[model samples]
Target: MTLAHEMAFASPQITAYAVEATEYPDLARRYRVTGVPKTVVNEHIEILGGLPEDAFIEQALG
Candidate 1:
């Protein structure tokens, strides 16, 4: 989540959101979020767990 905020801060083109699964049950179901720290980029790229900064950037922007 920190990396996401940092990336958003670094690039105007990037936007990040942090959602609590317990709070937003419908959204969690929509995204099929089975774990914490799930990252969905543009509603297409679904990253299911924690990732290194570089690797995350590559997948997100590659």
Candidate 2:
């Protein structure tokens, strides 16, 4: 799904927060993010690897 579509259905008005690994070394360590494709959503939902567009959005939205 497109980011636009995800935004369309998102609650709490939908927001995306992005932080570079270097910017938050502590968080990176806690999350065990060693690769480039890791994705963590809301700090609770950790998607360890890349996924298809639809699947990624589904997880984030949930």
Clashing pairs in 2: none
TM-score of each: 0.93, 0.60
lDDT of 2 at 48: 58
* Predicted candidate 1 versus true structure: per-residue lDDT over 18-56, tens digit per residue: 888999999999999988889999998888789888999
What's model 1's TM-score? Answer: 0.93
The 10 consecutive residues of candidate 2 with the worst lDDT sum are 1-10
Model 2 earns a TM-score of 0.60
As for candidate 1, its clashing pairs are none
Stretches of model 1 off by over 4 angstroms after superposition = none
Clashes of each: 0, 0
